[model samples]
Every structure is written in C-alpha cells, then in structure tokens.
Target: MERKHKRLATRRAAGVAGVVFAVLTAAAITLVRTALPGGGDDVTLDAGQRGGLRTALELVPFAGIAFLWFMGALREQGGRAEDRFVATVFLGSGVVFVATLFGAAAAAGTVLGDGTQDSTFGSHFAYALLTTYAMRMAAVFIIATSTIGRRLGALPRPLVAIGYLAGLTLLVAGSGVPWSEMVFPAWALLLSLNILWGRPPAAAPRTAPA
Candidate 1:
C-alpha cells in the first residue's frame, strides 16, 4: 500500500511538472518570437518587444527547474522496469538540453543587456544554440522517453507515435522550420495529460483453484 501511494505521488508530480514545463517553455518561445525583429533585416527593439524578451529570459530558469523535477518523476514512474542503457541516454540528453537552453537564453540576455540589437553574431549564435543543439537534445530525450514508456506499458500507442514523429521533426528540421519547436512542448503537454488522467490497463482475473 505504501509503495502504491508512492507511485501515485510520483505520477502526479511528473504530470504536473511536465505540464508546467511545457507551458513555461511555450510562453517563453512565443515571447521571444514576438520580440524578434522582422526578417532579420532590422535590429531595432521597441520598448514592448524589449520587455517581452526580458520576460522570456526571466522565465527560463523556472522552466528548467520544472523540467528537472519532471525528469525525476518520469524516471520514478518507470521504476524497476526501466532499461539502464536507455535511461542513461534519456537523462543525459535532458541535462544537455536544459544546459543548452540556458546557454541560449544567457546569450540572448547578453545582447539585450548591452543595448545592442544589431549584434547579428550574438543573435544568430543564440538562435543556433536554441534551435540546433537544444532541440536536437530534446529529440533524443523524447525518443528515449517514448521508448521506455512504451516498453513499460506506461504510454499509449498514439502518444508513443506522436513522440516519434515529434522527435523526427526536431531532428530533421533543426531550426527556422516554422513552429517546429512548438512540437516539443505540445508533445510534453499531451504526455503529461495522459499521465494525469489515464489509468493503467487492468489485469485479468485469475481462476480460483479447485
């Protein structure tokens, strides 16, 4: 009973954390996109846009923290059924993804702090870090998570298929693919909803002994 309660607690934590992480990351991406100059041809930032960029930067840390908690809870959800090799890849990729994301946010913050919107190199570098390295790592994380969940019978087939599709899109598109990054958050949101509301399959009843 105690073990059952613990598992339930972890599942709830994982679900909530995934939802929070997805929302925060999506919000940050939207704000950053809104604040970016048009067509890379201009480098001027209006006050509102500047404020949006700053807000996005501020939200990143909390998002990272929530993601870490989500990762922990997800691993806990796997319990004894987790494959060690896949788990290592999942954990490593997730950590790298967060680090790269933070690095990108920091890069963007530097450009904004210096009051120079015209730093083409700085902006491009930050964008590369985010859509390139960070998203690639995210793809790996998604693939590993989906594989483990499916193997453990924790995730539905539809959700697993979506994960594979999202991972492939991120891997192939990299950056500037028009709403590509949104896939990550969307996948996470769906997975979280499943964990939150969906139940495990019921076991068949055993026959009584004669």
Candidate 2:
C-alpha cells in the first residue's frame, strides 16, 4: 500500500511539473521568437518587445526548475527496471539541455543592455545556444526517454513513435527551421498527460502452488 501510494505521488508530481515546464517554456519561446525572429543581427526591438523579452528571460529559470522536477519524477517512475546506459543518456541530456537553455537566456539578457553591437552579438549567441545546442540535447533526451519507455512497456507505440519523430525533428531541423524548438515542449506535454491519465502497468502474475 505504501509503495502504491508513493508511486501515485510521483505520478502526480511528474504530471504537474511537466505541465508547468511545457507551458512556461512554450510562452518563453513565443516571446523570444516574437522579439527577435531569426536572430538577425540587424533586428531591432521596440519598448513592448523589450518588455516581452524580459518576461521570457524571467520565466526561463523557473521553467528549467520545473523541467528538472519533471525529469526526476519520470526517472523515479522507471525504478529498478531502467537500463543504466539509456538512463545515463537520459539524465545527461536533460541536465545539459537545462544548462544550455540557461546559457541562452543569459546571452539574450545581454541584449537588453546598451550597445547595438552587443545586442546583435547577444541575439546571435542566444539563438545558437537555444536552437543548436540545447535542442540537440533535448532531442537526445527525448530519444532516450522513448527507448526506456518502450523497453519498460510504459508508453504506447504511438506515443513512442511521436517521441522519436519529435526528437529527430529537433536533432536534424531545429536550427535550420524557425520555431521547430516548440516540438520539445509539445512532446513533453503529451508524455506528461499520458503519465497522468494512462493506466498503470499490470503486475506480474504469480505462480500457483505446485
């Protein structure tokens, strides 16, 4: 009973954290994309755009925090059945994604300061970190997570397929395509909803006495 209760608590935590992370991340990305589309060097921001950028930057840290909680809760759900190699990839990629995301936010923050040259450079740096590095890490995280879920029979085939598709999109087309980064948060939201509402895996059948 205690174990069952613990699992339920973890599931709830994962669902809540995942939803928060997805919403905050999507909002931040939208704000940033609107403020500095394509990360062009010559782009200029108006007062409203600047305010939006600031709001996006401010939301990033909290989003990162929620992501960490979401990741941790998912790992806990995997429990002892998890493969160490894939789990390592999952944890590493997630941590790196958050780090790169924070780095991008920091770079973007520099744009708010004086100097036109600094703003241009900051925007370029921010986009590079976000689209190139962070998204790639997110891709690996998604792929690894899907692999684990498949092995554990925790995720349906359709959901696993979607994870792979989204991960590949972020890996191959993220930097080349504008707004492709949204795929990561969208995948997270879907996976989180599954965890929240899907039926728990059934227990192994016990052998009858001989």
Candidate 3:
C-alpha cells in the first residue's frame, strides 16, 4: 500500500476505536437501565440504575474527545478544510459545536449529581449530549466532503447536501433530550462506512510550521 493509504488506515483505526469506545459506553448505560431490579409492571427507576446510566453516559464525552483527537490527526497531516468546501463549512461549524459540548460537559460535570426536577446538571448533561450528537452528524459531512472530486464523483452533491441538512434538522429537533443513546446505531453505520468502505483522500502535503 502507498504511504497515503497507510495514513488513512491509521486514521481509520483511531476513528473506529473512538467509535467503539463510544458505543460500549452507550451499551453500558442501556444495560444498566434494563437491569434495574423492577417487577413486571411499569415501575419506578432505581436510584442506582439512574446513577449508573448517568455515570455511563458521562463517559461518552470523553469518547467524543478521543474521536476528535483522531480527526485532529487527520487535520494534523494537513487535512485542509478547503479540500472539500461543503465539508470544510461543516467542519468549521463542528469546531464550534464540539467546543460548546466540551464547555457544557465541563460545566455540568463540575456540579455532578445535583439533580432537581426543574433542571439539574444531569439535565444540562442531557442537552449537552444531544448537542454532541448533533456534532455526530458531522461525520456524514466528513465522508461526503472527503469523497468529493474523487472516484465517488458520480454521487450527487445534492444528496450529501440534503443529508447534512436533514441531520441539522434532527439536531434542532428534540432538545432537552439526551440523544446520545439514540445515535449509537447510526454511529455504528457511519463507523462501518469509514472502516469497511473508505477511499482515503490524498495525504495532505506537509507544511512548514509558522
């Protein structure tokens, strides 16, 4: 394999690791929820289960940070935003989006476990998770942008555009929801696309540090 191919493979591995960690975190949360010791009928959730779920969900942001670190590697190897214009736009938006997620996570994490019926740090974390999830939609942008002007040229630009628009629509929907739970299935699909079927873009040219 060529050197560029090697780099893409490496980056793909890091991304897949990030995705796998995130999915496992979600699985832990779900399992904790289901394992709540409740009888057959509709039941009150146990504090332990709720805390376990929160604890599991809390780990997810770190997974996202790890994924961003992988993306950072891709960017470090001279991944230029302008390489794919639409993707560049989304990436720029993603920079701000993830930054917000980090901030929100930090703020809520500082006051962890302080729950109120009105709005708790837990509630804020839920919102932050959904916002982070909206950030997940960026992968569609990443793949589409990265694939453009390449062999996938036959694929319509509008389709990618619409997919992103639709993702944005979903992002705006269902606020106050901790959607990190919901996106894992879709995240798995995206991860597979990157892993099983990616056509690595050309390695970005090396640059002199300013």
TM-score of every model? 0.91, 0.94, 0.54
Which ranking of candidates, highest TM-score first? 2, 1, 3
Candidate 1 per-residue lDDT over residues 88-150, each given as its tens digit: 999999999999999989877755654465465566777888888999999999999999988
Give the winner by TM-score: 1 or 3. 1
* Local error of candidate 3 at residue 27 (angstroms): 4.4
Candidate 1 versus the native: TM-score? Answer: 0.91
- Backbone clash pairs in model 2 (N, Cα, C under 3 Å; residues 3+ apart or in different chains), count: 0
| Model 1, runs deviating above 4 Å | 37-41, 114-118, 201-210
What local distance difference test score does each model get?
0.85, 0.91, 0.48
- Which candidate would rank higher by lDDT, 2 or 3? 2
Worst 10 residues of 3 by lDDT: 35-44
Choose the strongest candidate by TM-score: 2
Predicted model with the maximum lDDT? 2
Runs of candidate 3 exceeding 4 Å displacement: 21-45, 73-88, 107-168, 176-181, 184-188, 197-210
lDDT of 2 by residue, 61-165 (tens): 999999999999999888877889999999999999999999999999988877488778888999999999999999999999999999989889999999999
